[model samples]
Target: MVTPTESIKWKRRPLSTMGQTYKALNFEESVLCSPTQYFKRYIPDDLFTSIAAYTIIYALQQGKSSFNLPMYWDTSLKVNVFWENISRDRFLELRTNLHLVNNLEKPPENKDKFYKFRPVYTAIRKRCSDLPIEENVCVDEGIIPFTAKFTAKQCVRGNQVHGESMSSCCVESVLLFQVLKSQGINAVGTVRQNRFGKNLPFSDDKTIMKQTRGYCEEITSADEITMCKWLDNRPIVLCSNFVGKGSVDEVELWNKKHHKYVKVERSEIVRKYNHAMGGVDLFDQLISSYIVFIRSRKWSCV
Candidate 1:
């Protein structure tokens, strides 16, 4: 029998199988598109693999203009090996025909919106599942900017760019939570205030200042799921199964009246939430700073 204190060990392996699966699915989609076309002339599996690698490298190497024929020209970037190997026409052809999953088959009702990128989605989820769970795991949402029309696209108000509103679950946040709990990993996250029902155990009459400065409430369900709600500028709520209730810490808060920073007693839940909630946001920020400016209709490619 496994002890509660024991950690789960993850196996490390190459993701070549995922690449092979992608190639097969993409080739099938391409074949289905042009069944009458000559098989001998069709793009080979090796060429597709090369194209995938080239695309990733191109995205990494930034250029003045977006990914276009001109960007890969000799005059623009001298002695470019990638551009010389693949012709412009062939690149465009592959880009146009690339497909992750077959559209003919109807997806399940719940996953219909995300059917287009289902293959890539599944691959990512599998990769996440294979990773070892950390003792302290944080969950948060990250938006993928996609102006193109897609069923799963969500428009977040106040964001400068319009795009799909993917929640933390896209990165397997909920799955990680469940898995980590089984291994005794602590998980914390800031959830939407409205997620709580109207019949909250805590009173709604609390002032915003009182809540934001320092206030914590512990809630437990019949199933023994421990959740916490604390006040800090706004109502910050979290669900942490491993953390104990009533733990407090001192945090610095700005006082508008006195025009100085004041130390206030804050709950441990608030401190942990503030410290751990930025993993996804930090990732989004880093990618946004250096992301390739290429535009695409496909949400997955974007």
Candidate 2:
């Protein structure tokens, strides 16, 4: 009989398969799309019966994201966390042994930084591409929660953002904007100071902040390219082939040190970016709300 380790190895690289009319697909994107999709694909007949039996009871018992495993195994009742359906040891073994892909088949070290989630991420990218393309679309990175220790941990994590990322100012310039303009597409986005034209320079955030909070600087090219920097709660720089500094309007901004909202002058360019960028934020918010929570160190499991 094949042992668990051997079985896992076999899964990582399937040696052979029984005769089939078509390739057997173990992992399907729709299965990961929704709870209903998951139940439909995996356990259609037993889905409702099992959920009615155990799912609601466990959910009512505790928080959705707050399952404590070590605590569950504790001998003391006062400190011990409990699950009605499974023992802690058994659950741990199940989690540790679970294999979506063979570790041996992982991409060479550093070649693919996130080899673990490649399949899931590729699937997500595929699904995102299948979505209807609009003239205005924004690409932002998605966050996958890792409760345990990891090397690539970052302080910031937000919604299920995914798409084709816009190039940084390093890759974006008057030349690139001109190309977009030639294609009848106007581009406007936030830029960093280091790569934004050196000949056309603006004061740093500290210098700008030292002046009136509404202070701003603008440089417009003969061909209509605009480079703008404004100081509000912070210094922000923007570059575009089309939009430039227009009517300055007052908007409320939270003054953190003062603990109140203060009126700050906002230019038309900033206002337009804020209004349009809402589409990206909305996309992230909607998908993030429905992400399935799987308790595993692997980002792909989520």
| Leading candidate by lDDT | 2
Candidate 1 vs. true structure, TM-score: 0.59
TM-score, cand. 2 vs. native: 0.49
On residues 65-125, what C-alpha lDDT tens digit does candidate 1 reach at each position?
2334533434366556656776565566446555444444454565566665555555556
Best of the candidates, TM-score? 1
lDDT of 1 at 193: 38
Tens-place lDDT digits, model 2, residues 131-205? 555545454455554455555544442644322232223334456666666676667778755554454545667
Q: Which stretches of candidate 1 lie over 4 Å from their true place?
A: 1-79, 101-112, 158-161, 167-186, 205-212, 254-259, 291-302
Question: In angstroms, what RMSD does candidate 2 have relative to the true structure?
Answer: 18.2
TM-score of every candidate: 0.59, 0.49
